[model samples]
Target: MARRGKKAKGRPISGWVILDKPKGMGSTDCVSKLKWLYFAQKCGHAGTLDPLATGLLPIAFGDATKTVPYVMDGRKTYRFTVRWGVQTTTDDTEGEAVGTSDLRPNADEIRDLLPNYTGEIEQVPPSFSAIKIGGERAYDLARSGEAPEIESRIVTVHSLGLVEMPDADSAVFEAECGKGTYVRAIARDLGRDLGCFGHITELRRTTVGAFTEEDMVPLDELIDVADENREELDEEAIESGAKARILDFGPLDEYIIAPEAALSELYEVMLNDDQAGRVLAGNSVLLRGRDAPAFCDEAFATGHGRLIALGAIDQGSFHPKRVFGGKG
Candidate 1:
């Protein structure tokens, strides 16, 4: 049998899109919406956010998707509301109430408890979650009436603070954490420490890696653009929106961020023609310039105003670890 290469269609879009995800929309659903509006050939989100959670969701299109792992590994900051006296199946408001209480802690007590969650700790994820048990999703097992014992794992919380007490029944929190740290689990544990059952009433991610609230765009606004450009988009035009402030120019240019922007923390070292050629051809090149590294694990390479590849520098030599070109 002769094997054949698969064909790809749709716009060859390549860039980063930060979406201010609205509540009730799954992260995948939000990415799908963005992909459809842009008509991109490929798209994916940096991280998964539960339907009950909202805020900064980074969506990468085409070549930008290659950098998603970098963003996912970066630190994240969140602002969440914990509703005391209620513990739920999922540890969030969307889940059914599993336990309740009349206990509520005051500001001094809450502040005292904040330090307990601020450093390295063993945290157990909620039963209703995306974690895999055997081959099936943990959430699926929970929905099917199975009690899957989720073991505790070590997670780092860079910082955790009590933002405010919105009401007698709720307390707001701000947490900046490393990868795999769940805000929902924090609420669950806090209630246990404060003598009141707790669950996340509301949650918003303020930051994810290098992307922040300032970079996010609302879904309605993006959809509105596709609607306004219907005449040019032809039958492929998105008409999901019936309202918006119409503009003569297409709004997409204003929203797209350069794929290289994802490597803002990484020092970019523009390679010469020779170095670029050698790196692209899967060969190592020497670094002798003033900008040459003491030694870095990786640096974004650029040539002729284009992202070339992610180069690995060691002992003043550069090697191409991940190529960014020819993504089509």
Candidate 2:
């Protein structure tokens, strides 16, 4: 007889954790810490934020991981401050100064340049970015003393405006843009256009997809909540040292937003018991009723207010692309 494989540890919890990522921590590190805290079976992030940047980082656990692509495809809003006079290799303060300038543009001058950057435009990502070239990350190659040529691609900027000018050396701006848009590149290009040569001094992402700063939970707060619940464990378990072994997600579950929250943009179809069963089994269910959509390239099915599957609608039938667990 064949030997059975070991089962994965942790609870199979599923939800979204909108983290207020602290500065000096990488996105991957944030995910790891949250996973360990929640003791979740699976976890992922919708987008990458540099270690120096802070604010909203949408993390997905278990079934929510299936919707990461949708969250990443949503628009993002960022507020950043640019130091006008020096350009860096990374286009952020984390990099070394590659060039300098003495010129500074006033408020009106900066506002005048905003329109040119709005709408679709070509942008070359920073050399120290995560973009891959020849199967290696651009940043990795740059750190190895190799100058990797990064190609320019078109990205959409929904709106760009000057928020304020704190001083002659720095200007604050807010931008709402589509997926793949680089805020660092915006600051770099703005400086170059103004002949001031700039780099991002501070960056904060306020929104990503349906997640906003309001949804963010600080790490300290989560830690405090978990620590406070330790007293609830039984004395017997504590004496046996099984208290540490027990992974009760009840305390932390309140902070986790429902997984369907990430899929708000997709068309949702309410399914009956039979329909949901078929969807859960990786099959198609005919969309009926007056409100039924004729066709949708991407949509989700929910049964009894719980997510059943992420799929597509064609010819009046919803085909399950990814089936999810749970009664919903």
Candidate 3:
């Protein structure tokens, strides 16, 4: 008889891991690296950060992956530096410089320009972006010297402030924006608006939804702990030990958030044993309590603080749209 293959490794770990990503690491790579270090069965990130950018990258594991959409749709905050008088093909320092000017905007000029960018505004994404044109990414088109016809879309910039006039040729800014907003585009447009070519010199994401820099762990720190435990008997042993070191920080139970924490902004309805059973079965049931509504679309059904199902209320009923890993 032929020998059977070995069983798959890694734990069915569930929850969020906020990583303070460093520059030069792509978001997809960061997710993959963290997935291996944690030995999680599943992994995903809230948003994609450019390889040239750094900071808060919320990574979800196993059941927490179900809540990725909620975090992805939430507010985002960024800190970026705009280098005036020079523009590049990629609209960032890494790209070849395509244009330059001697004119630089003064502090007062930048401050005056901030109001124009705040609130709702029309923005054309940078050509060198992940946005799709036909079946291909726009950046891929730009890379081939093909101009991707990108249209303007309304994106909300909740707030924009001039953080500092760091030098005669650059200005630092902090922006609170909604999903789909591009800081690179902002720098490019700001340069044009200021009568000088502009490009991003540095960029960092400070927050995404309820997660922030305060909740992030540097990848190197986590990797070092795992490296020290390499002599452990198995993958689980090393993963457990690495988590133990990280858990001392208290932001996570074991390098993972409580699964329910992913949907913290949504209203929660704790179900009774019978109701929990119904939800786990992928069935709808009436919710008990004064806050229960006819249509609580943005709600989560929980049992003893554990996520049972995420769904909506219709006709005064709780429905299980997306059940957790335990089939609930």
Candidate 4:
């Protein structure tokens, strides 16, 4: 991978990269690969995916890292296949087999059980996870032979549909879930309820917020793809490159999507250049602009306005908190 030179020989590249992460690679490893591939100074992933899990992992390069949190909050959809009658130490196939059961639930029985997991449910994260416990990673503690008590958290499963039931011993499911929903936990709990222990045999993230697997580039393909159109790789090139790579894979204008594109879903109040400056300076600006039906006053009243992000009124005019670029 070619490294970006310290001196700005070309423009700096910055934007999101939708990576179709391959299994057996950690999220951090994927980010590092992209960082090297693009010659980016700063790069981070919106969310972590276990090495056993593969699918869409959004990589934020340059300024896009600042908006990673916003993207992380978005809902995720996954397609996972679970094998019944066996339980692994880590809940997924990556771990040692800890237990087994002979009995397996039928497809009809599984469909009946799926509804119970739909909507809101309580889940405990896997022990072999990045969760911090007493200032140490939970996985580290677990690996150190410590029994760390993990608290169960409430997570939402918006929808769960059975995609395929090949046999009584295995099933494939498509699930739309809110942030923090652990699919491994669901598999474990489901197996427990069915009188058979189970673990995730395979998992792939289908969607994360607005990004989807269809929008993702395979990690190998990304490595193979050449960054040849190396004009000025500034914000414009970065944005254009991301759109081209993820959305269209065609030539795009430097400004295909503005910095504000990251925050278009949030309620916004257009500010004058001066107000924009103040907002950028970290001051809370009142909503005085024309009322947008999309803008909720109650939400704004309760610091939802603070949740709002800023953008320039026009070209050359500056807005405070250009959330996409400045921080990275």
CA lDDT scores, all candidates in order: 0.85, 0.90, 0.85, 0.70
* Candidate 3: C-alpha RMSD after superposition: 4.7
lDDT by residue (tens digit), candidate 3, 1-328: 9999977566677788899999999999999998877766778999999999999999988888888988999999999999999999899988888888999899988888889898999999989999999999999999898999999999999999998897899999999999999999999998999999899989999999989777888898878766665443567876666533333223223566767776889888789888888888899998766766778767898884578888888888988888874421
Q: In candidate 4, how many Å is residue 279 off? A: 6.2
Question: Would you estimate the TM-scores of all the predictions?
Answer: 0.91, 0.93, 0.89, 0.75
Q: For residues 1-328, could you state the per-residue lDDT of candidate 2 as single tens digits?
A: 9999989777788889999999999999999989988877888999999999999999999889988998999999999999999999899988899899889999999999899999999999888889999999999999999999999999999999999899899999999999888899999999999998999999999999999988999988988777766555588877877655324557788998988999988999889998888888888999888888889999999885678889899999999998888421
Return the number of clashes found in candidate 4.
2
- Model 1 TM-score (2 dp): 0.91
Clashing pairs in 3: 308-328, 324-328
lDDT: worst 10-residue window of model 3: 244-253
| Residue 159 in candidate 3, Cα distance off native in Å | 0.5
lDDT of model 1, residue 131: 83
Predicted model with the maximum TM-score:
2
**Alpha-carbon deviation at 233 in model 4, angstroms:** 23
TM-score of 2: 0.93
Error of 4 at 301 (Å): 19
How many clashes in each candidate? 0, 0, 2, 2
Give lDDT: candidate 3, residue 71: 92
Query: Model 2: residues >4 Å from true position, as ranges?
Result: 231-248, 326-328
Q: For candidate 1, lDDT tens digit of each residue in 1-328?
A: 9998887766776788899899999998998888777777899999898998889999998888888988999999999999999999989977898899998999999999888898899999889888898998889999999999888999999999998987899999899999999899999999989999899989999898999899988888887776876554334344754433233334775688888878888878787888888777888788877867868987878765667788778888777788876542
